[model samples]
Target: IVQTYVENTRLIWYRHFCNCTLINGKFIFGYYRLIPSYGLELIVEILLNTRLISISSTRSNTIRKRLHICQPFINKHHFEYREIIDIKTNESIYQLNLVVVSSNKDTTLIRLIENFEREVLKYPNRHQCFTLTILYFYQKNQTINQIYDLIHQLSIKYTSIIRLSIINQNQINYNRGLGRQLASKLFSNKQLLFFLDVDLIFTGQALDNIRQLMIHQLSISSCTVYFPIIFSYFSSMFNVNNRTVIDINSNIGSFSIYGYGNVVVRKQDLDKTGGWEINNHEWGNEDVNLFQRFSESSSECNVFRTVEPGLKHYYHKKMCNGIVNRERQKICYDADGVLLGSQRNMIIIPYGMSSISTIDCSSFEPYDKPISTWKTLVTNLNAAERDYVKSYLGQSLVEQCEEIEGEIDSLLDIWRDYRNETVANCTNPTIHSLAEPPVLRQRLTTEIEFFVKHI
Candidate 1:
């Protein structure tokens, strides 16, 4: 039957067979005489009906010359396989809902959103599953129309990936934790919720890292919460004119983990813990309070502190001025800095670990004393007394206070020097001092460099 079919079709398909060679008991066609472009397809079709187990191209000049013609089809199929893999990978990625709270009309908000979108777009697979919920906590001074316009523009620009939600409220009573809880409630479809401050900008690699962490957590169970260590620092104060510039070489202590900054928790886990506490509207210790609540939640819940650097905080004066007041609220935290409440402790399950551990907040001394008394104790402590103070306050809390004190002192020194130079240049003017203005400016620049490099 095969012999008859080949003989009968030989007349019509003779040109296709003209360049044929029998290798390893299978017919290999070199080129099609009439339709060269359709040659590979025809060969593949013919082989599908035959007893051939495999296909190969010849290395001879005749076959190699026309082999280049089939390059497009080969590349096309290659991309098709890649597209399939990408789609599968994307489907596996769990949904990440980023909740951002913006109250004031800080111009930096736009930059923060842009940088976030840019970072999310870097991972196409992850971006497809990511959603951004922006909760605009309304203030009286902020222009309502301007806020609407900004929201509209962002909605249109990120129509495909981002799910934007803008909520308006009349009072200035919205805190970070409350705003995040509201945003999470607004978007119920998301599996994971990441609370992000409006002033913080995350890198693309950092986003990818968080995505992987979320995926790992999801694989274990849907009720898992992860917190990435936020790298927070004031933008170089001396170089106020240069926005978006951060000192990369600064110590890790400069980037303390603020409770409100880069926090990742499962929506289900949040629900289990009754979401973030909304009572603290003044933005003081809401994040810390919420963290303590999570720690004291049910034992099945998994909470972890990721040691990776995933988020960076931009410099803002409001944050700098509010630090002292915020730190004062930390006295409510246990000696280990965990919020005080609940005899029932929450379990912390590290990534890739089957065993679970509880946060022991019992060893630290009680924060019954006022902030002034605590400051007095810290100030009067000698080397031995300092170690004793650390034992009561916990080493982490003491180190953080010391770091903040150093930073404040450095900032005050820089401000004084800059002010003195400006006043001197303005008050005492001479022909030689005309050149002194430029010299003073140069000195200011040098001082900024020295501060960033040495500090």
Candidate 2:
């Protein structure tokens, strides 16, 4: 079947337009070059029957209008996979080989693995059809360290779901590409391979869409791969890391249009397309390199860059592993400095009152609109609004602001102290320095700005 795909590709590709090898020679006609255009339709005779698949049909027109995908930089479709969603049983055309790259003995693996079991493995379609390989960082002693100890527990708890592949190096620096490439080698070249990180949380619904796209949209002849646009959270402070935030609409994260990781591809397709760049290590540009290669106009490979719902990247303190090129270093630092999603207004209203429960972990959405009257009354108590709170709510407002000023107002100061302790706790200086103290302060200020609508 692979050889047949290669043969068909060779016959169809024009060397003047694409990277594929020529069958006999080059095509002199420019019109033939138009065959590969995104919107252009052509005949593709496949097994059992013939179907007319339109080019790049996104499920949601609303998100596409907001997505702003440049010409070919990112694949621009949002497929909800509404057809397969209701099927509690999802049997796909291919078996999924999920490679979750982990290093540094982190306890967050517990959240990741458990969430995977609850969300992805809950469906009969995935639980039976998937093989999860954890590419763990090197460890000599499992008892002393929290990260290693958790891995030990994981091996026992998820024996059915996990196959541990420990890297035999001290690995002071994280080589994401190397870890992913190594994991890929453990699987059959013909099987479907998904490269992932521990910070990602995805639902069974997302898996259904991914499988749908992988089976139907991907073709071996064109070397197609899928990079789903995941929603990335701002900070753990906004209740984003709370595993209970399952609904994508309820999520406080923004869609990362530029993120090219979280890939789903057949191992055979990956091998043919110059697999991952093993040399580009340190949590940078590794994913981007593959995306860029196929995004080119002349490339024979077809990349299905779609914004599939249900995948989420939880917040973490990120630092450029200091090994990527100057360009990626800038990209990494710029990513580190971002935080507008934590706006209080975006938090409160989006989920209505359930957000109060999600954020505090102590409340739930009420049966009635209990607080609506007072909430409306205070805001309208004279246009000046300075003395408005004292009108009805009284000392309640003053007392709460006092508590906020005394406690929550010093979030930056508290973070700085925590950063210092973590140095003693500060192993995360890059994240704490760039993402926490400054960005938290910035987010808080920005929230006030967004609320007040003033400078």
Instruction: Estimate candidate 1's alpha-carbon lDDT, on a 0 to 1 scale.
Output: 0.50
Best-fitting candidate, measured by TM-score? 2
At residue 335, give the lDDT of candidate 2. Answer: 65
CA lDDT, every prediction?
A: 0.50, 0.55
Give per-residue CA lDDT, model 1, range 232-328, as digits (tens): 5532312212334344423212345444456787666777777777776543566776666654423355556644555776545343223345455
- lDDT (10s digit) by residue, model 2, range 185-274: 887766778787688887777775676566655543446677887887765433434544554543466777778878888787777767
| TM-score attained by model 2 | 0.54
| TM-score for each model | 0.49, 0.54
State how far residue 164 of model 2 sits from its true place (Å): 1.0
Q: Which stretches of candidate 1 lie over 4 Å from their true place?
A: 1-93, 122-126, 144-147, 238-247, 251-253, 258-260, 318-455
